[model samples]
Target: MVKTAKKNKIHEQLTPKTVVIKIAKWFLILFFGIYTLFPLVWLFVTSLKTNAEYFDNPFSLPAVIQFQNYVNAFSQANLGRMIINSITVSVIATFINIMAAAMASYAISRFQFKGKEAIFAMFSAGVMVPLNALMVPYFTIFSRAGLLDSLNSLRILYAAIGLPMSVFIVRGFMDSFPREIEEAAYVDGCGFYGRFLRIVLPLTKTGLVTAATFQFLTCWNEFVYANLLTSSPATKTIQIGIRYFTNQFTTDYVSMYAAIVIAIIPSIIGYMLFQEQIISGLTSGAVKG
Candidate 1:
């Protein structure tokens, strides 16, 4: 029996079924890799081509690399200011979003109260609310509040808009957290605030980071509300500023591509930084919830 078991184990990976599965797995990986990366590669390549080169053959290699497109995007298009605006708004909004979500999620997950489930349901239900439908009322409210064209309005709106998803992710993690640690902390001369700030917050870092990354990206990439809210160049985000290259008569394709590449870099950087936490948060939530 032992020898037969050993033989089967040894031959398991060499079986036709196993070999076919291995090939299929790698084939899917290669296909997805190219699918996801090709557009980015094409964007970077096109950003280096001149207008004439792009007009001649977009897919072909550039005859001479046009570094000037980046320069023009920064100087002529004022992409630098827009990028800074995007960073500022996204960072502040993400902080606000995550903080509110953490508190709300903690309360919803760990504490029992009247209407708690209802409130949680409300927050979760917010994910179904359409931004487009609310634009008119939101515009009216912001206008009445004297917040139109203001970055603060954008920050607050971005935070509010991302709140539901943040709460959803953070609550999943918080629910999975063992309560014994909090109970222990409570018995050890720790107050409610201390238990939350020191014990719960520290342990929930992965969930917080995952939620923050999603919130930050949402704030960073959001366009329709941004365009609707801000008209001034100083207040415009990187998304709205990307359209400066286009008009009725002509479009600066290469420079637009350069600005796009610039805009994408920060998001990529952010994802890379929190990728591990995000992955852990997702898997842990799935397994534990």
Candidate 2:
């Protein structure tokens, strides 16, 4: 009788409210999962279909899989050159932005000096500045400097644009880090650079990966700046190269879809690789200060 009563009491603890909440949570998860994945699934399906098939039955599976579309998309779009350009620019820009932001964030987060808050505020404010607002000035400045129409110009621009957000993210993570480690290093005669290079940097790997992922994606997908600044075929990025498939009159939907899939692969791979770190870094410092 006693065991039966206790079992009844325990089962009653899971109230109707709790059951409803659980159901709602799963509902939201299913809803968003379908919403996010449907577009990618459709894009893949469209990429495999011929233009005639696409026109005949857009939503149905491809009657005959056109593997040649991928090859045509690659060669005709000159994605080979564009992919190389995007990787080079994104990699170099991400490296420079991460290195500079890490150093700046470390100084700001660890040091005490006049205008420290002000400096941090300035970088944070840069995040609000829209890229479109600076497009004209960037064009004029680069044109006069004889830097337009070159990959170096794009590299520099991408690095500069990514700096503010990187600094903000890294600084937030640094601020949340325990200071005892650094103090102990100091007592052991470790200088500022040594402490930063050895202890702080390694401890902040999640933050660094988060910042690098953001910077790389920004540089890779950026189209307006690439289009405005770069005029030559050799310097154009994948985003800009995608425009070649469409003009005022005609649009190659199949090839264009294929190219989009190619362009998005790197970003998907990158996110999948560093998703845990990104989630951890974003949430770690969120409640710290």
Candidate 3:
């Protein structure tokens, strides 16, 4: 009788959540999952429909797939060129962003200097500043310097803007790292760059990949700044190319959907390829921390 009472008592404490609460939690998750996935499902459906069919039955599946829309989207809009341009810009920006943020984060985490806390505070403060507010001044400066409308110019700007947040994230991850590894490497005659390149970087590879992936996505899909800065066809990115299918009076929804599907290809591939890295980095930070 005493053992039974004790077992009952333990069960009471462990099973705090009632059946009704569990049911409600599952319902909430199901609702959110559908809400998030519905748009992507709609996009694929729309891409397969003709313009008339798309407008007439936005929710309905196509009777016959209009695969020509994909062909037209690329050929008519010169999306191939835009894809190449976006890839180049994104790759360059991602490289610069990851390198700058990684070095800055490592320095801030490991080194001791005067005003160190104040400098870290300044960097933290920069995260709260809105990029939109600085656009006017940035435009004026870039204009005077004759860097506006150039691919290299835009890359530098994107990397600079992305740096503050990237540094904070990387620094947060680096903070959880033990100092003994770095100290041991130092003892073994590894200088700052040597230790960083050979030891620190290998250990933080997942975090670096996460940062680079985000930077690539941002650089590739960035429309507002790219549209605002570059007016020439040669320098325009995929986002700009996608906009060509839309106008004031008439909009080619089929073509637009096709373009969107095409644009998603690279990002999807990137995510799939680096998913393991992202998962590992996030899980390590959450669980190990």
TM-score of each: 0.95, 0.93, 0.89
Query: Candidate 2 regions off by >4 Å?
Result: 1-6, 13-16
> What's model 2's TM-score?
0.93
- For candidate 1, the 10 contiguous residues with the lowest summed lDDT are 280-289
> Which lDDT values do the candidates have, in the order given?
0.92, 0.93, 0.86
Write the residue-wise lDDT of candidate 2 on 1-289 in tens digits: 9999999987876789878998999999999999999999999999999999989988999988998889988888799999999999999999999999999999998889999999999999999999999999999999999999999999999999999999999998898888999999999999988998999989998999999999999999999999999999999899997898899998889999999999999999999999999998888858775
Candidate 1 stretches with Cα past 4 Å from truth are: 1-10
* lDDT per residue as tens, model 1, 73-174: 998779888998999999999999999999999999987899999999999999999988899988998999999999999999999989999999999989
User: What digit string (tens of lDDT, one per residue) describes model 3 on residues 1-289?
Assistant: 9999999988875674865677888999999999998998899889989988977879999999889999999988899999999999899998999999999889888889898778777877888998778888888888999988898878988898888777766777778878899999999999988988998888888888887888888888888889877889999999999989988999988989999998988998999999999888777766653
Location of the lowest summed lDDT over 10 successive residues in candidate 3: 280-289
Ranking by TM-score: 1, 2, 3
Score candidate 3 by lDDT. Answer: 0.86
Q: What is the lDDT of residue 170 in candidate 2?
A: 95
Which residue pairs overlap in candidate 1's backbone? none
**lDDT at 154, model 1:** 94
True-structure lDDT of candidate 1:
0.92
